[model samples]
Target chain A: MKNKGDIFVISAPSGTGKTTLVRLLLSRFPTLSFSISYTTRLPRPGEVNGQHYFFVSEKEFKKSIAKGEMLEWAKVYGHYYGTPLTFVQEKIAAGKDIVLDIDIQGAQAVKKKMPEAILIFLIPPSWNELQRRIISRSSDSPEEIKKRLEAAKKEILAAREFDYIVINDVLEDALKELVSIIQATKARANKRWPEIKRLLQA
Target chain B: MKNKGDIFVISAPSGTGKTTLVRLLLSRFPTLSFSISYTTRLPRPGEVNGQHYFFVSEKEFKKSIAKGEMLEWAKVYGHYYGTPLTFVQEKIAAGKDIVLDIDIQGAQAVKKKMPEAILIFLIPPSWNELQRRIISRSSDSPEEIKKRLEAAKKEILAAREFDYIVINDVLEDALKELVSIIQATKARANKRWPEIKRLLQA
Candidate 1:
């Protein structure tokens, strides 16, 4: 019998370079799978439907939520976004580790639903670095930047709830830490029980 | 404030290549420290007094035990062995991660006293491999080999008490897993709280 795979719920405030890290992580670990969220928000430039997100109508997104098909859902900035329960369950049952990139609230909801899910928070090295990243990556007005910074602080406080934290000081170092967390989780006793049992019996 | 370090307690059955893996792990992670146990047994070939173990008389070992200086101790093969409590506490409080190579009972004892200590178990990939390694590495008689195999089986069963398991299938792969476990533990939320808090305040 195969051991069930792990569910890694990774959350980070905007401008923490989480997206880039996740992209690199997925590429490095071929067996790792990403869970794409279903969103009612319009796709941004270069974002593909079903690849980046399953772009859905507001009614369709609401329908999934009402039908209990969504594992975790939240309305952020007036856009509905959620993870589908079946996809995550199927992948994990098939012994494929899945990465879920979501906001803090979504991560909390997922953790509540699936207590085994490993929660990871990504943060910038410092507040100044966080602000620099936000400003450099966006064309937001000073007021907008201020608002995002405030939100980031609140999210950073919630980081205490996470099981692991990756400091995005340097891309390479952050990626290496992230990879170590994934590889280490795979070595957990519960995850390797089947193979271990087989060896003992043999 | 400096971030408090971790105590990684690694346990394995005989012939699992644990000693080789641990030697390589310590070489790679210079910041990591090893906790040498005090033993009543005489030093084997190539074993240094303080480096390999603190060779002590049985009376001295029992005195330490009476004084509550031993962190964890066990009698095996008519020899007394134990960790020095003050050394582990001082190194950890000074922000140095320490690795403890101990038996299953000692690992369980350390965990009881220090709940935060991460316990890792190393095992051979297969029972046949475990037997082969034991036979090849020693000049033990067939009866001694049989006794060791029985002991190994019991130790393997105790692996469930561990937090992580590294299968010693390929030396390189096992070393990589061992390193990943150490790196990942350093990234744990509790371990990085000081740095994370400083960033938030800044």
Candidate 2:
């Protein structure tokens, strides 16, 4: 039998450049799968139905939660968001490593449901750097920027709970660390058991 | 305070090309320290006193073992070989990572004495390939080759107990995997706790 794949859950505070890092990681590892979340919110102009998210009506989303189909669900700004259990299970069973980019709360929820999931937390170099990144986004008002900085502080404290931490000091360096973590996981004894057995018998 | 460095214990069966991979790894990572072993056996031609092996008399070796200064020691072919504990401790305390290349029995002993030591086992790709490599060494007689192959089989079985297993198939690929394991260990939560604390306070 093929060895089961690993599930990596990545979480970071706002303005930490988590999205950019995750995008680069996925692009580099073609075989690695990305876990798409189910959302009740309407898709943006560029978002695809299945590729971006499994967009569903509020009624359908609630039905899935009641049926226990959602692996982890949360309501934010009156819109429901969650991971579907079946997709992750099927991919992992087929030996496909999957990456999930979510918030700290979502990461905790995923860990509770799937204890095998590896949780990684990303952070900026310093509080000042985080504030600079947030304020530089002209789209946010001063009040929104202030609120984001406050949230970033609380999220930074949760870094202690993560299995691994990647400091986003230089984009290239952070990417290297992230890649190393993924590659190292594949060398775990449990994951390489099948090959070990074959060699022994041969 | 600086984070205490990690102890990496690498074990491999005979003819696995472990020596080449380890030498390359040390050259690539200049900051990593190699744990020099003490041996009662006389040094081979051109071997340096301190750089190759700490050549000492049986009296000195036994005294160190009695004082519990030896981390792990074994008597092979009527000669004593062992690792010194104080050197390892001092290097780690000074925030320097150390690598120990030894046999499976030595690796197990180090793990028992230092529970945090990471044990990595290296193996050849296949049984046939292993035999080919061993026979290619013209120095060994047929009887000696047969004995060595038996020992290799026993060591291969011990790979299951290791924390990581690296297959020495292609030299370059194996080196990359070994390097990734070292880099990933540095990102463990406990190692990065100090940085996380500074970020939280900031």
The TM-score values for the models, in the order shown, are 0.97, 0.96
Q: Per-residue lDDT for A178 in model 1?
A: 89
Model 1, residue pairs in steric clash: none
DockQ of 2: 0.76
Clashes of each: 0, 0
- Tens digits of per-residue lDDT, candidate 2, A118-173, equal 88999899888888888886488889888888888988888788889989999989
What are the runs in model 1 whose C-alpha is more than 4 Å off?
none
Distance from true location, Cα of A170 in model 2, Å: 0.6
True contacts kept of each: 0.78, 0.74
lDDT at B44 for candidate 1? 96
lDDT of 1 at B29: 88
The sequence of per-residue lDDT tens digits that candidate 1 reaches over residues B92-134 is 9999999999999999999999999999999998999999999
Q: Which sections of candidate 2 miss by over 4 Å?
A: A138-143
Error of 2 at A191 (Å): 1.3
Alpha carbon deviation, residue A60, candidate 2 (Å): 1.1
